[model samples]
Target chain A: DTAVSQTPKYLVTQMGNDKSIKCEQNLGHDTMYWYKQDSKKFLKIMFSYNNKELIINETVPNRFSPKSPDKAHLNLHINSLELGDSAVYFCASSQWGGGAGMETQYFGPGTRLLVL
Target chain B: EDQVTQSPEALRLQEGESSSLNCSYTVSGLRGLFWYRQDPGKGPEFLFTLYSAGEEKEKERLKATLTKKESFLHITAPKPEDSATYLCAVCGTSGSRLTFGEGTQLTVNP
Candidate 1:
């Protein structure tokens, strides 16, 4: 079974279109995260949710909003996609404990988005 | 601000060649250091985690060692299948987020 999974492995749309990406984890983790990998292969954290509560929000654009319906699912909605928003989006999950930072995170296959 | 920098950016090795990748980080309070291997068109797979200085972990041909200022992923006798972009990340006590490096693209030629 896949520990983590994301739908729409590839996305291509106009610059002004709205889009969303879905993620789910069967690992029974308490925390989920979203990260973006740019063309240079630099991975950066975008958002984190713990038990459906927002925990970490990086300096991402306001157009990018993350929602956690339950501990197992986290969805990202973009209001107005831009060319700069085109990147590989990865979903991750970890079992949060005393120190959540020390936990090992498992990642999904990633969603490739390309905005023209 | 927490920052991570990976050296060499890219590396090339022949089959059976051994090498090490460096990841330097600066954070307020170090919580853990993690190593992940990512293949093209796939998500990163967890390899090891080093919680403190002098901590070391190993898996097959990969061995990760951590220090106060940096961490190293040493691959011994690497094979073509071992080729991938190795990412280094750190979790500082300041927050529940991880700061990742630019990643090192390792190519092992057979």
Candidate 2:
């Protein structure tokens, strides 16, 4: 079974439109995160939710928002999507935060979002 | 700012040959360093986690070693299937808000 899963593996949309991507983890991890990988393959963290609590929020556009219904799910919603938003968005989860950078993060298969 | 950089953007290797990939980082504190493998059109798969300087971890044909500011992933006797992009990430004291490198793509020709 897949540890982390994201829906709509391939999402093709248009600019100025709105879209949402969903992620779920079956690892029983307490923290779920959202990361965006650009054309350069630079993977950057967007948001992280710990036990359904927002823990980390990186420098992301205001058009992007993350919602965590519970510990097992984290969803990303984008408004007024721009062409620059075309990239692979990955969802990840970890069991606990070491607060000292000692934990391993598990990543999902990633959702390829294409804005045309 | 915290950053991770991997060298040799791409590598072409002959089967049964061995080599090492590098991952250098600039962060505030030394938390933990991670190693992952990514095939095309897929997410990264975890391989090893090194906690402190001089720590090492190994699995199958891959071995990971970490220092204060960098880490190295050594692939021994690599096979054709071992070809993939090796990604390194760092998560410091705050959380596993990992910062990933551009990744090193390895292509092993049998």
Candidate 3:
């Protein structure tokens, strides 16, 4: 069974188009995250939701928004996408507690978005 | 500011060759340090989590050790299947988010 899964493994869209990437995790984790890996392979966190509550919001542009209907699902919606948004978007989940080895995160098989 | 930097961005080794990868970080308060291995077209697989200095964990041919300011992932007799991009990330007391390094890509040839 796939622990974490994402839709639209490869997405190619034109500029100014809006797109959404869906993510779901079966690990029953409380924390979910959205990361963007640019062409330089630098992974940066964009947003994080803990138990469906917004926890971490980085310095991302306003065009990008993340919605978590519940703890098991997190979706990212990009509005009026630009060429600079072309990168690999990854979804990750984790269960954090006051203990050792509980901070490990399991990631989904990323969604590659290409804005032409 | 919190940051994680990995050295020797890419390395190529023959089968059975042994080497070590470095993960250096600068954070205000350290919560945990994590190591992950990522294959092409797939997500990252969790490997180890080091909480404090002098802590060590090993699996198969890989051993991870943590220090005050850095961590090392040592690989011995690595095979082709062990080749992947190793990522290091850290979480501090200020937040639950992780700051990730640029990752080191290792390639082992049989």
In terms of TM-score, the best-performing candidate is 1
Q: Rate residue A52 of model 2 by lDDT.
A: 91
In candidate 1 the C-alpha lDDT for residue B51 amounts to 91
| Candidate with the greatest DockQ versus the true structure | 1
Query: Which candidate, 1 or 2, would have the higher lDDT against the true structure?
Result: 1
On residues A1-116, what C-alpha lDDT tens digit does candidate 1 reach at each position?
98999998999999999999999999999999999999999999899889999988989999999999999999999988999999999999999875466788899999999999
**Worst lDDT 10-window in candidate 3 chain B:** B91-100
In order, the Cα lDDT scores of the candidates are 0.93, 0.89, 0.91
For model 1, residues B1-110, the per-residue Cα lDDT tens digits are 88999987999999999999999999999988989999999999999988999999999999999989999999999999999999999988887678899999999999
lDDT ranking, high to low? 1, 3, 2
| Candidate 3: Cα lDDT at B25 | 96
- The Cα error of candidate 2 at residue B89, in Å, is 1.3
Runs of candidate 2 with Cα error greater than 4 angstroms are A98-101, B94-96
Regions more than 4 Å wrong, model 1:
none
> Which stretch of 10 consecutive residues in model 1 chain A shows the poorest summed lDDT?
A96-105
Q: List TM-scores of chain B, every candidate.
A: 0.98, 0.96, 0.98
